[model samples]
Target chain A: MTRIEEAIKQSKFQDVYQKALVNLIYTANCLRDEQVRILKPFDLLPQHFNVMRILRGRHPKPVCPGEIKEVMLDKANDLTRLLDKLERKGLIQRNLCPTNRRKMDITLTQAGIELLEKMNHMMEQTHETLKGRLSEREAASLSHLLDKLRG
Target chain B: MTRIEEAIKQSKFQDVYQKALVNLIYTANCLRDEQVRILKPFDLLPQHFNVMRILRGRHPKPVCPGEIKEVMLDKANDLTRLLDKLERKGLIQRNLCPTNRRKMDITLTQAGIELLEKMNHMMEQTHETLKGRLSEREAASLSHLLDKLRG
Candidate 1:
Protein backbone atom coordinates (compact mmCIF):
# COMPACT_ATOMS: atom_id res chain seq x y z
CA MET A 1 0.00 0.00 0.00
CA THR A 2 1.09 3.57 -0.70
CA ARG A 3 1.19 6.39 1.83
CA ILE A 4 -2.35 7.34 0.79
CA GLU A 5 -3.64 3.81 1.31
CA GLU A 6 -1.89 3.61 4.62
CA ALA A 7 -2.93 7.12 5.58
CA ILE A 8 -6.57 6.30 5.05
CA LYS A 9 -6.10 2.84 6.60
CA GLN A 10 -7.44 1.25 3.44
CA SER A 11 -5.40 -1.71 2.35
CA LYS A 12 -6.83 -1.67 -1.16
CA PHE A 13 -9.09 0.30 -3.40
CA GLN A 14 -11.88 -1.02 -5.59
CA ASP A 15 -9.42 -1.10 -8.47
CA VAL A 16 -6.36 0.61 -9.90
CA TYR A 17 -8.46 3.36 -11.50
CA GLN A 18 -10.05 4.34 -8.23
CA LYS A 19 -6.69 4.06 -6.53
CA ALA A 20 -5.08 6.39 -9.06
CA LEU A 21 -7.80 8.98 -8.52
CA VAL A 22 -7.22 9.04 -4.78
CA ASN A 23 -3.45 8.97 -5.20
CA LEU A 24 -3.52 11.99 -7.50
CA ILE A 25 -5.34 14.08 -4.87
CA TYR A 26 -3.10 12.94 -2.00
CA THR A 27 0.15 13.43 -3.89
CA ALA A 28 -0.87 16.94 -4.89
CA ASN A 29 -1.52 17.85 -1.25
CA CYS A 30 1.90 16.50 -0.29
CA LEU A 31 3.56 18.70 -2.90
CA ARG A 32 1.45 21.71 -1.92
CA ASP A 33 2.28 21.32 1.77
CA GLU A 34 5.97 21.35 0.97
CA GLN A 35 5.63 24.65 -0.92
CA VAL A 36 3.39 26.04 1.81
CA ARG A 37 6.13 25.32 4.36
CA ILE A 38 8.67 27.28 2.32
CA LEU A 39 6.25 30.19 1.89
CA LYS A 40 5.55 30.35 5.67
CA PRO A 41 8.74 32.32 6.40
CA PHE A 42 7.69 35.00 3.92
CA ASP A 43 4.26 35.44 5.53
CA LEU A 44 2.66 34.46 2.22
CA LEU A 45 -0.04 31.98 1.50
CA PRO A 46 0.43 29.63 -1.45
CA GLN A 47 -2.17 31.57 -3.47
CA HIS A 48 -0.32 34.79 -2.67
CA PHE A 49 2.85 33.31 -4.06
CA ASN A 50 0.99 32.12 -7.11
CA VAL A 51 -0.46 35.57 -7.75
CA MET A 52 2.97 37.06 -7.29
CA ARG A 53 4.42 34.67 -9.81
CA ILE A 54 1.72 35.62 -12.31
CA LEU A 55 2.32 39.32 -11.70
CA ARG A 56 6.03 38.84 -12.23
CA GLY A 57 5.27 37.33 -15.59
CA ARG A 58 3.42 40.56 -16.43
CA HIS A 59 6.22 42.61 -14.73
CA PRO A 60 6.42 46.02 -16.39
CA LYS A 61 3.15 45.37 -18.20
CA PRO A 62 -0.08 45.68 -16.22
CA VAL A 63 -2.70 42.95 -16.03
CA CYS A 64 -6.36 42.82 -15.07
CA PRO A 65 -8.05 40.44 -12.71
CA GLY A 66 -9.62 38.54 -15.60
CA GLU A 67 -6.22 38.17 -17.23
CA ILE A 68 -4.72 36.80 -14.03
CA LYS A 69 -7.70 34.48 -13.60
CA GLU A 70 -6.97 32.93 -17.00
CA VAL A 71 -3.68 31.43 -15.83
CA MET A 72 -4.32 30.63 -12.18
CA LEU A 73 -4.35 26.91 -11.41
CA ASP A 74 -6.74 27.20 -8.49
CA LYS A 75 -9.89 28.57 -10.03
CA ALA A 76 -11.52 29.04 -6.62
CA ASN A 77 -9.16 31.90 -5.68
CA ASP A 78 -10.76 35.32 -5.87
CA LEU A 79 -8.39 37.40 -8.01
CA THR A 80 -9.96 40.64 -6.86
CA ARG A 81 -9.61 39.72 -3.19
CA LEU A 82 -6.09 38.46 -3.76
CA LEU A 83 -5.12 41.68 -5.49
CA ASP A 84 -6.65 43.67 -2.67
CA LYS A 85 -4.53 41.82 -0.11
CA LEU A 86 -1.41 42.15 -2.25
CA GLU A 87 -2.11 45.83 -2.66
CA ARG A 88 -2.47 46.25 1.11
CA LYS A 89 0.76 44.35 1.66
CA GLY A 90 2.61 46.70 -0.70
CA LEU A 91 3.59 43.76 -2.86
CA ILE A 92 1.66 44.89 -5.92
CA GLN A 93 0.51 48.19 -7.41
CA ARG A 94 -2.95 48.85 -8.79
CA ASN A 95 -3.97 51.58 -11.15
CA LEU A 96 -6.46 52.41 -13.87
CA CYS A 97 -5.26 51.32 -17.28
CA PRO A 98 -3.96 54.38 -19.10
CA THR A 99 -5.68 53.32 -22.30
CA ASN A 100 -8.96 52.44 -20.62
CA ARG A 101 -10.15 54.16 -17.45
CA ARG A 102 -12.87 51.56 -16.90
CA LYS A 103 -10.31 48.76 -16.60
CA MET A 104 -8.06 48.23 -13.57
CA ASP A 105 -4.38 47.49 -14.09
CA ILE A 106 -2.21 45.52 -11.69
CA THR A 107 1.53 45.17 -11.73
CA LEU A 108 4.22 43.81 -9.46
CA THR A 109 5.93 46.32 -7.24
CA GLN A 110 9.67 46.16 -6.60
CA ALA A 111 8.94 44.24 -3.39
CA GLY A 112 6.79 41.74 -5.24
CA ILE A 113 9.49 41.03 -7.81
CA GLU A 114 12.06 40.64 -5.07
CA LEU A 115 9.77 38.32 -3.15
CA LEU A 116 9.17 36.15 -6.22
CA GLU A 117 12.88 35.98 -6.96
CA LYS A 118 13.44 34.62 -3.48
CA MET A 119 10.49 32.28 -3.76
CA ASN A 120 11.52 31.07 -7.19
CA HIS A 121 14.92 30.12 -5.78
CA MET A 122 13.25 28.35 -2.86
CA MET A 123 10.77 26.66 -5.15
CA GLU A 124 13.56 25.58 -7.42
CA GLN A 125 15.27 23.97 -4.46
CA THR A 126 12.04 22.32 -3.34
CA HIS A 127 11.36 21.10 -6.87
CA GLU A 128 14.86 19.72 -7.13
CA THR A 129 14.58 17.92 -3.80
CA LEU A 130 11.20 16.54 -4.85
CA LYS A 131 12.58 15.51 -8.23
CA GLY A 132 15.31 13.58 -6.45
CA ARG A 133 12.59 11.17 -5.39
CA LEU A 134 11.91 10.44 -9.07
CA SER A 135 14.40 10.04 -11.89
CA GLU A 136 14.36 12.29 -14.95
CA ARG A 137 12.68 9.48 -16.89
CA GLU A 138 10.20 8.86 -14.10
CA ALA A 139 9.38 12.54 -13.91
CA ALA A 140 8.73 12.75 -17.63
CA SER A 141 6.52 9.68 -17.49
CA LEU A 142 4.65 11.11 -14.54
CA SER A 143 3.97 14.32 -16.43
CA HIS A 144 2.73 12.36 -19.42
CA LEU A 145 0.45 10.23 -17.27
CA LEU A 146 -0.98 13.30 -15.53
CA ASP A 147 -1.77 14.92 -18.86
CA LYS A 148 -3.51 11.80 -20.09
CA LEU A 149 -5.46 11.50 -16.86
CA ARG A 150 -6.96 14.91 -17.48
CA GLY A 151 -7.55 14.13 -21.14
CA MET B 1 2.05 21.69 -24.80
CA THR B 2 -0.75 20.26 -22.71
CA ARG B 3 -3.77 21.96 -21.10
CA ILE B 4 -1.61 22.92 -18.11
CA GLU B 5 0.97 24.40 -20.39
CA GLU B 6 -1.76 26.50 -21.95
CA ALA B 7 -3.53 27.13 -18.64
CA ILE B 8 -0.39 28.62 -17.08
CA LYS B 9 0.60 30.13 -20.45
CA GLN B 10 4.01 28.51 -20.10
CA SER B 11 4.89 26.75 -23.33
CA LYS B 12 7.61 24.78 -21.59
CA PHE B 13 8.74 24.15 -18.07
CA GLN B 14 12.35 24.42 -16.86
CA ASP B 15 12.31 20.70 -17.33
CA VAL B 16 10.03 17.65 -17.12
CA TYR B 17 10.45 17.59 -13.34
CA GLN B 18 9.04 21.07 -12.96
CA LYS B 19 6.32 20.31 -15.43
CA ALA B 20 5.38 17.19 -13.48
CA LEU B 21 5.19 19.23 -10.29
CA VAL B 22 2.83 21.76 -11.82
CA ASN B 23 0.81 19.08 -13.59
CA LEU B 24 0.32 17.15 -10.36
CA ILE B 25 -1.11 20.16 -8.55
CA TYR B 26 -3.33 21.22 -11.45
CA THR B 27 -4.71 17.75 -12.05
CA ALA B 28 -5.59 17.38 -8.39
CA ASN B 29 -7.52 20.63 -8.48
CA CYS B 30 -9.36 19.46 -11.57
CA LEU B 31 -10.47 16.28 -9.82
CA ARG B 32 -11.42 18.16 -6.68
CA ASP B 33 -13.55 20.65 -8.57
CA GLU B 34 -15.42 17.83 -10.24
CA GLN B 35 -16.22 16.29 -6.86
CA VAL B 36 -17.12 19.70 -5.48
CA ARG B 37 -19.64 20.15 -8.29
CA ILE B 38 -21.33 16.87 -7.38
CA LEU B 39 -21.50 17.86 -3.73
CA LYS B 40 -22.98 21.26 -4.60
CA PRO B 41 -26.53 19.98 -5.08
CA PHE B 42 -26.44 18.32 -1.66
CA ASP B 43 -25.37 21.65 -0.12
CA LEU B 44 -22.41 19.91 1.38
CA LEU B 45 -18.69 20.51 1.10
CA PRO B 46 -16.45 17.65 0.06
CA GLN B 47 -15.06 17.43 3.60
CA HIS B 48 -18.58 16.92 4.88
CA PHE B 49 -19.03 14.03 2.47
CA ASN B 50 -15.69 12.68 3.58
CA VAL B 51 -16.77 12.66 7.23
CA MET B 52 -19.94 10.83 6.30
CA ARG B 53 -17.95 8.25 4.40
CA ILE B 54 -15.72 7.64 7.40
CA LEU B 55 -18.67 7.27 9.74
CA ARG B 56 -20.30 4.89 7.29
CA GLY B 57 -17.16 2.79 7.46
CA ARG B 58 -17.81 2.45 11.18
CA HIS B 59 -21.56 1.93 10.51
CA PRO B 60 -23.35 0.94 13.73
CA LYS B 61 -20.28 1.67 15.82
CA PRO B 62 -19.63 5.24 16.81
CA VAL B 63 -16.29 6.97 16.25
CA CYS B 64 -14.48 9.82 17.95
CA PRO B 65 -13.07 13.02 16.53
CA GLY B 66 -9.56 11.68 16.91
CA GLU B 67 -10.36 8.58 14.87
CA ILE B 68 -11.98 10.66 12.09
CA LYS B 69 -9.02 13.04 12.03
CA GLU B 70 -6.64 10.15 11.53
CA VAL B 71 -8.02 9.31 8.07
CA MET B 72 -9.09 12.69 6.67
CA LEU B 73 -7.39 13.61 3.41
CA ASP B 74 -7.43 17.30 4.25
CA LYS B 75 -5.79 17.24 7.66
CA ALA B 76 -6.58 20.94 8.05
CA ASN B 77 -10.30 20.27 8.35
CA ASP B 78 -11.21 20.68 12.03
CA LEU B 79 -12.93 17.41 12.92
CA THR B 80 -14.92 18.93 15.76
CA ARG B 81 -16.22 21.79 13.62
CA LEU B 82 -17.07 19.31 10.88
CA LEU B 83 -18.94 17.04 13.31
CA ASP B 84 -20.83 20.03 14.61
CA LYS B 85 -21.99 20.89 11.11
CA LEU B 86 -22.82 17.28 10.24
CA GLU B 87 -24.75 16.88 13.48
CA ARG B 88 -26.68 20.04 12.70
CA LYS B 89 -27.49 18.70 9.25
CA GLY B 90 -28.87 15.58 10.93
CA LEU B 91 -26.40 13.45 9.03
CA ILE B 92 -24.54 12.27 12.08
CA GLN B 93 -25.25 11.58 15.73
CA ARG B 94 -22.83 12.14 18.60
CA ASN B 95 -23.21 10.69 22.06
CA LEU B 96 -21.06 10.19 25.10
CA CYS B 97 -19.02 7.03 24.95
CA PRO B 98 -20.43 4.65 27.54
CA THR B 99 -16.96 3.55 28.64
CA ASN B 100 -15.39 7.05 28.57
CA ARG B 101 -17.34 10.03 29.83
CA ARG B 102 -14.66 12.41 28.69
CA LYS B 103 -14.92 11.27 25.06
CA MET B 104 -17.76 11.37 22.53
CA ASP B 105 -18.71 8.83 19.90
CA ILE B 106 -20.16 9.71 16.47
CA THR B 107 -22.05 7.63 13.97
CA LEU B 108 -23.84 8.11 10.68
CA THR B 109 -27.57 8.78 10.89
CA GLN B 110 -29.86 7.00 8.45
CA ALA B 111 -30.14 10.20 6.46
CA GLY B 112 -26.36 10.28 6.24
CA ILE B 113 -26.31 6.69 5.00
CA GLU B 114 -28.93 7.49 2.38
CA LEU B 115 -27.00 10.56 1.29
CA LEU B 116 -23.83 8.55 0.92
CA GLU B 117 -25.56 5.86 -1.07
CA LYS B 118 -26.71 8.49 -3.56
CA MET B 119 -23.26 10.07 -3.63
CA ASN B 120 -21.62 6.71 -4.09
CA HIS B 121 -23.72 6.21 -7.20
CA MET B 122 -22.82 9.63 -8.49
CA MET B 123 -19.16 9.05 -7.68
CA GLU B 124 -19.25 5.70 -9.37
CA GLN B 125 -20.49 7.36 -12.53
CA THR B 126 -17.87 10.09 -12.27
CA HIS B 127 -15.10 7.59 -11.62
CA GLU B 128 -16.19 5.43 -14.50
CA THR B 129 -16.33 8.41 -16.85
CA LEU B 130 -12.91 9.56 -15.71
CA LYS B 131 -11.46 6.09 -15.99
CA GLY B 132 -12.72 5.85 -19.55
CA ARG B 133 -10.14 8.44 -20.49
CA LEU B 134 -7.36 5.97 -19.70
CA SER B 135 -6.96 2.30 -20.36
CA GLU B 136 -6.80 -0.07 -17.43
CA ARG B 137 -3.08 -0.54 -17.98
CA GLU B 138 -2.56 3.21 -18.15
CA ALA B 139 -4.51 3.69 -14.96
CA ALA B 140 -2.41 1.11 -13.16
CA SER B 141 0.78 2.70 -14.40
CA LEU B 142 -0.47 6.11 -13.33
CA SER B 143 -1.25 4.80 -9.86
CA HIS B 144 2.18 3.20 -9.59
CA LEU B 145 3.97 6.33 -10.79
CA LEU B 146 2.00 8.46 -8.34
CA ASP B 147 2.96 6.09 -5.51
CA LYS B 148 6.60 6.27 -6.57
CA LEU B 149 6.48 10.05 -6.73
CA ARG B 150 5.45 10.18 -3.07
CA GLY B 151 7.85 7.43 -2.06
Candidate 2:
Protein backbone atom coordinates (compact mmCIF):
# COMPACT_ATOMS: atom_id res chain seq x y z
CA MET A 1 0.00 0.00 0.00
CA THR A 2 1.10 3.54 -0.61
CA ARG A 3 1.97 5.84 2.24
CA ILE A 4 -1.24 7.80 1.54
CA GLU A 5 -3.31 4.66 1.66
CA GLU A 6 -1.64 3.74 4.90
CA ALA A 7 -2.23 7.22 6.23
CA ILE A 8 -5.92 6.95 5.38
CA LYS A 9 -6.24 3.57 7.03
CA GLN A 10 -4.57 4.74 10.19
CA SER A 11 -6.01 8.23 10.43
CA LYS A 12 -7.87 8.84 13.69
CA PHE A 13 -8.82 12.42 13.12
CA GLN A 14 -12.52 13.10 12.62
CA ASP A 15 -11.57 16.68 11.83
CA VAL A 16 -10.24 16.91 8.29
CA TYR A 17 -8.18 20.01 8.97
CA GLN A 18 -5.88 17.85 11.01
CA LYS A 19 -4.62 16.32 7.75
CA ALA A 20 -5.93 18.63 5.03
CA LEU A 21 -2.62 18.98 3.23
CA VAL A 22 -2.07 15.28 2.66
CA ASN A 23 -5.71 14.70 1.83
CA LEU A 24 -5.76 17.39 -0.88
CA ILE A 25 -2.61 16.14 -2.54
CA TYR A 26 -3.77 12.54 -2.22
CA THR A 27 -7.19 13.23 -3.75
CA ALA A 28 -5.82 15.32 -6.62
CA ASN A 29 -3.33 12.59 -7.44
CA CYS A 30 -6.14 10.02 -7.45
CA LEU A 31 -8.25 12.13 -9.80
CA ARG A 32 -5.29 12.75 -12.09
CA ASP A 33 -4.42 9.06 -12.11
CA GLU A 34 -7.90 8.18 -13.31
CA GLN A 35 -7.68 10.86 -15.98
CA VAL A 36 -4.28 9.60 -17.13
CA ARG A 37 -5.61 6.06 -17.58
CA ILE A 38 -8.59 7.15 -19.66
CA LEU A 39 -6.64 9.73 -21.67
CA LYS A 40 -3.86 7.25 -22.51
CA PRO A 41 -6.13 5.36 -24.92
CA PHE A 42 -6.44 8.56 -26.94
CA ASP A 43 -2.68 9.16 -26.79
CA LEU A 44 -3.33 12.33 -24.80
CA LEU A 45 -2.21 13.70 -21.47
CA PRO A 46 -4.23 15.71 -18.92
CA GLN A 47 -2.61 18.90 -20.17
CA HIS A 48 -3.73 18.04 -23.68
CA PHE A 49 -7.28 17.40 -22.51
CA ASN A 50 -7.19 20.74 -20.71
CA VAL A 51 -6.10 22.56 -23.86
CA MET A 52 -8.73 20.83 -25.98
CA ARG A 53 -11.46 21.74 -23.51
CA ILE A 54 -10.43 25.35 -23.60
CA LEU A 55 -10.54 25.35 -27.39
CA ARG A 56 -13.95 23.72 -27.39
CA GLY A 57 -15.20 26.36 -24.98
CA ARG A 58 -14.29 29.10 -27.41
CA HIS A 59 -15.62 27.19 -30.41
CA PRO A 60 -16.64 29.39 -33.38
CA LYS A 61 -14.31 32.00 -31.89
CA PRO A 62 -10.62 31.49 -32.25
CA VAL A 63 -8.40 32.04 -29.22
CA CYS A 64 -4.72 32.90 -28.91
CA PRO A 65 -1.94 31.08 -27.08
CA GLY A 66 -1.87 33.80 -24.44
CA GLU A 67 -5.60 33.31 -23.71
CA ILE A 68 -5.09 29.56 -23.54
CA LYS A 69 -2.22 30.09 -21.16
CA GLU A 70 -4.35 32.35 -18.95
CA VAL A 71 -7.05 29.65 -18.66
CA MET A 72 -4.89 26.50 -18.71
CA LEU A 73 -5.37 24.33 -15.65
CA ASP A 74 -1.67 23.67 -15.42
CA LYS A 75 -0.46 27.13 -16.48
CA ALA A 76 2.50 25.34 -18.04
CA ASN A 77 5.24 27.72 -19.13
CA ASP A 78 5.99 25.20 -21.87
CA LEU A 79 2.53 25.45 -23.49
CA THR A 80 4.09 26.43 -26.79
CA ARG A 81 5.95 23.11 -26.79
CA LEU A 82 2.83 21.19 -25.73
CA LEU A 83 0.78 22.89 -28.45
CA ASP A 84 3.52 22.04 -30.94
CA LYS A 85 3.10 18.39 -30.04
CA LEU A 86 -0.70 18.60 -30.40
CA GLU A 87 -0.39 20.40 -33.71
CA ARG A 88 1.97 17.65 -34.86
CA LYS A 89 -0.68 15.07 -33.91
CA GLY A 90 -3.23 16.89 -36.09
CA LEU A 91 -5.53 17.31 -33.13
CA ILE A 92 -5.44 21.10 -33.31
CA GLN A 93 -4.58 23.91 -35.68
CA ARG A 94 -2.46 26.97 -35.10
CA ASN A 95 -2.91 29.99 -37.32
CA LEU A 96 -1.55 33.49 -37.17
CA CYS A 97 -4.11 35.86 -35.71
CA PRO A 98 -4.79 38.47 -38.40
CA THR A 99 -5.34 41.20 -35.83
CA ASN A 100 -2.23 40.44 -33.75
CA ARG A 101 0.79 39.16 -35.61
CA ARG A 102 2.46 38.32 -32.31
CA LYS A 103 -0.36 36.00 -31.19
CA MET A 104 -1.12 32.56 -32.64
CA ASP A 105 -4.81 31.61 -32.76
CA ILE A 106 -5.66 28.03 -31.74
CA THR A 107 -8.72 26.00 -32.63
CA LEU A 108 -9.75 22.36 -32.45
CA THR A 109 -9.59 20.38 -35.65
CA GLN A 110 -12.42 18.01 -36.57
CA ALA A 111 -10.29 15.20 -35.21
CA GLY A 112 -10.03 16.96 -31.86
CA ILE A 113 -13.80 17.38 -31.56
CA GLU A 114 -14.36 13.74 -32.47
CA LEU A 115 -11.78 12.67 -29.92
CA LEU A 116 -13.55 14.71 -27.24
CA GLU A 117 -16.95 13.29 -28.20
CA LYS A 118 -15.61 9.75 -27.97
CA MET A 119 -14.20 10.45 -24.54
CA ASN A 120 -17.33 12.18 -23.19
CA HIS A 121 -18.80 8.98 -21.83
CA MET A 122 -15.49 8.03 -20.27
CA MET A 123 -15.28 11.43 -18.61
CA GLU A 124 -18.79 10.99 -17.29
CA GLN A 125 -17.91 7.53 -16.03
CA THR A 126 -14.87 8.86 -14.22
CA HIS A 127 -17.00 11.47 -12.45
CA GLU A 128 -19.75 8.93 -11.79
CA THR A 129 -17.27 6.55 -10.21
CA LEU A 130 -16.12 9.29 -7.87
CA LYS A 131 -19.63 10.62 -7.34
CA GLY A 132 -20.71 7.23 -6.04
CA ARG A 133 -18.45 7.76 -3.08
CA LEU A 134 -20.21 10.95 -1.98
CA SER A 135 -23.77 12.23 -1.88
CA GLU A 136 -24.82 15.15 -4.07
CA ARG A 137 -24.92 17.30 -0.98
CA GLU A 138 -21.46 16.12 -0.07
CA ALA A 139 -20.14 16.88 -3.53
CA ALA A 140 -21.54 20.39 -3.53
CA SER A 141 -20.24 20.98 -0.04
CA LEU A 142 -16.88 19.68 -1.12
CA SER A 143 -16.83 22.02 -4.07
CA HIS A 144 -17.90 24.91 -1.92
CA LEU A 145 -15.30 24.20 0.73
CA LEU A 146 -12.64 23.93 -1.91
CA ASP A 147 -13.64 27.34 -3.27
CA LYS A 148 -13.58 28.80 0.18
CA LEU A 149 -10.21 27.26 0.83
CA ARG A 150 -8.84 29.04 -2.22
CA GLY A 151 -10.06 32.40 -0.95
CA MET B 1 -6.20 38.30 -12.95
CA THR B 2 -5.81 34.59 -13.61
CA ARG B 3 -8.32 32.74 -15.79
CA ILE B 4 -9.82 31.24 -12.66
CA GLU B 5 -10.10 34.64 -11.05
CA GLU B 6 -11.97 35.93 -14.08
CA ALA B 7 -14.11 32.79 -14.29
CA ILE B 8 -15.19 33.25 -10.71
CA LYS B 9 -16.10 36.84 -11.45
CA GLN B 10 -18.10 35.87 -14.53
CA SER B 11 -20.01 33.24 -12.50
CA LYS B 12 -20.11 30.90 -15.48
CA PHE B 13 -21.15 27.42 -14.30
CA GLN B 14 -19.63 25.58 -17.22
CA ASP B 15 -16.76 27.99 -17.04
CA VAL B 16 -16.90 27.53 -13.30
CA TYR B 17 -16.23 23.79 -13.47
CA GLN B 18 -13.44 24.43 -15.93
CA LYS B 19 -12.14 27.09 -13.60
CA ALA B 20 -12.59 24.76 -10.64
CA LEU B 21 -10.35 22.25 -12.31
CA VAL B 22 -7.92 25.04 -12.93
CA ASN B 23 -8.33 26.19 -9.35
CA LEU B 24 -7.39 22.77 -8.02
CA ILE B 25 -4.43 22.69 -10.34
CA TYR B 26 -3.46 26.25 -9.39
CA THR B 27 -3.88 25.60 -5.68
CA ALA B 28 -1.61 22.61 -5.93
CA ASN B 29 0.74 24.64 -8.05
CA CYS B 30 0.77 27.41 -5.46
CA LEU B 31 1.52 25.01 -2.63
CA ARG B 32 4.29 23.48 -4.68
CA ASP B 33 5.43 26.98 -5.57
CA GLU B 34 5.79 27.82 -1.91
CA GLN B 35 7.47 24.52 -1.21
CA VAL B 36 9.94 25.11 -3.99
CA ARG B 37 10.62 28.60 -2.71
CA ILE B 38 11.29 27.34 0.80
CA LEU B 39 13.37 24.46 -0.46
CA LYS B 40 15.41 26.47 -2.92
CA PRO B 41 17.43 28.12 -0.15
CA PHE B 42 18.35 24.58 0.85
CA ASP B 43 18.53 23.37 -2.76
CA LEU B 44 15.70 20.80 -2.55
CA LEU B 45 12.34 20.07 -4.12
CA PRO B 46 9.33 18.84 -2.14
CA GLN B 47 10.14 15.33 -3.34
CA HIS B 48 13.58 15.58 -1.79
CA PHE B 49 11.99 16.83 1.42
CA ASN B 50 9.74 13.76 1.40
CA VAL B 51 12.75 11.48 1.04
CA MET B 52 14.48 13.11 3.98
CA ARG B 53 11.38 12.77 6.16
CA ILE B 54 11.13 9.09 5.21
CA LEU B 55 14.75 8.50 6.07
CA ARG B 56 14.29 10.25 9.38
CA GLY B 57 11.29 8.06 10.12
CA ARG B 58 13.58 5.04 9.89
CA HIS B 59 16.73 6.56 11.25
CA PRO B 60 19.68 4.22 11.85
CA LYS B 61 18.13 1.71 9.44
CA PRO B 62 18.96 2.24 5.82
CA VAL B 63 16.04 1.97 3.37
CA CYS B 64 16.01 0.66 -0.18
CA PRO B 65 14.63 2.63 -3.11
CA GLY B 66 11.71 0.21 -3.36
CA GLU B 67 10.83 0.82 0.30
CA ILE B 68 11.08 4.54 -0.25
CA LYS B 69 8.80 4.25 -3.28
CA GLU B 70 6.12 2.51 -1.20
CA VAL B 71 6.01 5.36 1.29
CA MET B 72 6.41 8.19 -1.18
CA LEU B 73 3.36 10.41 -1.65
CA ASP B 74 4.11 10.77 -5.36
CA LYS B 75 5.17 7.13 -5.94
CA ALA B 76 7.22 8.31 -8.91
CA ASN B 77 8.14 5.67 -11.47
CA ASP B 78 11.36 7.64 -11.88
CA LEU B 79 12.53 7.04 -8.31
CA THR B 80 15.87 5.88 -9.63
CA ARG B 81 16.29 9.26 -11.28
CA LEU B 82 15.11 11.08 -8.16
CA LEU B 83 17.48 9.09 -5.98
CA ASP B 84 20.25 9.71 -8.44
CA LYS B 85 19.58 13.43 -8.16
CA LEU B 86 19.68 13.33 -4.37
CA GLU B 87 22.77 11.17 -4.32
CA ARG B 88 24.46 13.58 -6.72
CA LYS B 89 23.69 16.46 -4.35
CA GLY B 90 25.24 14.54 -1.44
CA LEU B 91 21.98 14.59 0.55
CA ILE B 92 21.79 10.81 0.43
CA GLN B 93 24.18 7.89 -0.01
CA ARG B 94 23.52 4.41 -1.40
CA ASN B 95 25.16 1.16 -0.35
CA LEU B 96 24.47 -2.27 -1.80
CA CYS B 97 22.81 -4.60 0.66
CA PRO B 98 24.77 -7.70 1.61
CA THR B 99 21.90 -10.07 0.87
CA ASN B 100 20.54 -8.35 -2.25
CA ARG B 101 22.88 -6.91 -4.81
CA ARG B 102 19.86 -5.83 -6.80
CA LYS B 103 18.80 -3.48 -3.98
CA MET B 104 20.73 -0.60 -2.51
CA ASP B 105 20.31 0.84 0.99
CA ILE B 106 19.73 4.61 1.26
CA THR B 107 20.60 6.81 4.21
CA LEU B 108 20.66 10.56 4.77
CA THR B 109 23.91 12.42 5.15
CA GLN B 110 24.54 14.95 7.93
CA ALA B 111 24.05 17.75 5.42
CA GLY B 112 20.58 16.40 4.58
CA ILE B 113 19.45 16.38 8.23
CA GLU B 114 20.76 19.85 8.88
CA LEU B 115 18.97 21.13 5.81
CA LEU B 116 15.70 19.60 6.94
CA GLU B 117 16.10 21.07 10.41
CA LYS B 118 16.59 24.53 9.01
CA MET B 119 13.47 24.27 6.87
CA ASN B 120 11.15 22.57 9.37
CA HIS B 121 9.63 25.85 10.58
CA MET B 122 9.32 27.09 7.03
CA MET B 123 7.30 24.02 6.13
CA GLU B 124 4.79 24.87 8.85
CA GLN B 125 4.64 28.38 7.51
CA THR B 126 3.80 27.03 4.07
CA HIS B 127 0.75 25.28 5.51
CA GLU B 128 -0.18 28.36 7.50
CA THR B 129 -0.16 30.57 4.42
CA LEU B 130 -2.53 28.21 2.59
CA LYS B 131 -4.83 27.85 5.56
CA GLY B 132 -5.01 31.57 6.03
CA ARG B 133 -8.08 31.80 3.82
CA LEU B 134 -10.18 29.26 5.66
CA SER B 135 -11.23 28.70 9.20
CA GLU B 136 -9.91 25.65 11.02
CA ARG B 137 -13.34 24.02 10.85
CA GLU B 138 -13.71 24.72 7.14
CA ALA B 139 -10.25 23.39 6.41
CA ALA B 140 -11.07 20.23 8.33
CA SER B 141 -14.30 19.71 6.42
CA LEU B 142 -12.58 20.35 3.13
CA SER B 143 -10.02 17.73 3.95
CA HIS B 144 -12.70 15.19 4.90
CA LEU B 145 -14.70 15.68 1.71
CA LEU B 146 -11.56 15.43 -0.39
CA ASP B 147 -10.72 12.10 1.26
CA LYS B 148 -14.25 10.78 0.86
CA LEU B 149 -14.31 11.94 -2.76
CA ARG B 150 -11.19 9.90 -3.45
CA GLY B 151 -12.77 6.77 -1.99
DockQ for each model: 0.70, 0.44
lDDT of 1 by residue, B1-151 (tens): 3467875787877788878888888889888998999999998888898778878877898988888888777764567887888899899999999999888999998998998999989989888777778888988888788877777
Ten contiguous residues minimizing lDDT sum, candidate 2 chain A: A7-16
Q: Chain B, TM-score, each prediction?
A: 0.92, 0.81
Best by lDDT: 1
Off by over 4 Å in 1: none
For all predicted structures, in order, the TM-scores are: 0.94, 0.88
Question: What is the C-alpha lDDT profile of model 2 across B1-151, one tens digit per residue?
Answer: 3344553333454433333444565566656676788889877788888888888777778999988887676677988888898889888889999899999999988877777788877777656655676788888777666656656
Best by DockQ: 1
TM-score of 2: 0.88
lDDT of 2: 0.73
Cα RMSDs, all models: 1.8, 3.1
DockQ for the candidate 2 complex?
Answer: 0.44
Q: How much is the lDDT of residue A86 in candidate 2?
A: 89
lDDT of model 2, residue A117: 83
